[model samples]
Target: MTLDPNTLLAILAMAAATVLTRVSGLVLIHFVTIGANQKRALEAIPPAVLMAVIAPTALVTGPAETLAALATALAAMRLPLLAAVATGVLVVAVGRAVIRV
Candidate 1:
């Protein structure tokens, strides 16, 4: 199947829309005044957003994937953030290799 010019344009437009939605808050923050209550809410936003992203993955993951994610999250909570991410990636990679063998 061939991708026509119109299809390519449509795909680009959809990608742009998705990116704009994701980054709109950062863009808007530069122009907006954040009050005390808003600031508190903003502080919670990262973990809330993370939970929203992670919860679905955790729920949908197979037993091995869930275990790997849990190990990564626990390590991240106790150690440096980057280390946690690395540990999680390692766990998932190792798990996948083991499953394949």
Candidate 2:
């Protein structure tokens, strides 16, 4: 099969977008001043962003997933990372199983 020029350009565009996205955060951080609240917010942002992204899906899918997410958050606060992850997965699995009954 012959490679088309438009396809090549599209691939390059996607690669550039990906590269810029990954580096933009690091680049922007150099300009920011960190204080105690800023430090805490930065630490919290990843999980907050993740849940924000997932929240609509959970809401659309219904209560079981949302409750499981709540359980996971509670478990995460008191447990080790790995254990918290396991707890989340287990809660989701068990909630799903029970919901189907």
TM-score of each: 0.53, 0.71
> lDDT at 28 for candidate 2?
95
Q: What count of clashes does model 1 give?
A: 0
Q: Per-residue alpha-carbon lDDT of model 1 for 15-89, expressed as tens digits? A: 999999879977887999989999999899998898799878885877657777888879977899889888988
Cα-based lDDT for every prediction: 0.85, 0.85
**What is the Cα-based lDDT of residue 30 in candidate 1?**
94
Worst 10 residues of 2 by lDDT: 58-67
Predicted candidate 2 versus true structure: per-residue lDDT over 35-61, tens digit per residue: 999899889999889889977887677
Model 2: CA > 4 A from native: 24-32
After superposition on all C-alphas, the RMSD of every candidate to the true structure, in Å, is: 4.7, 2.6
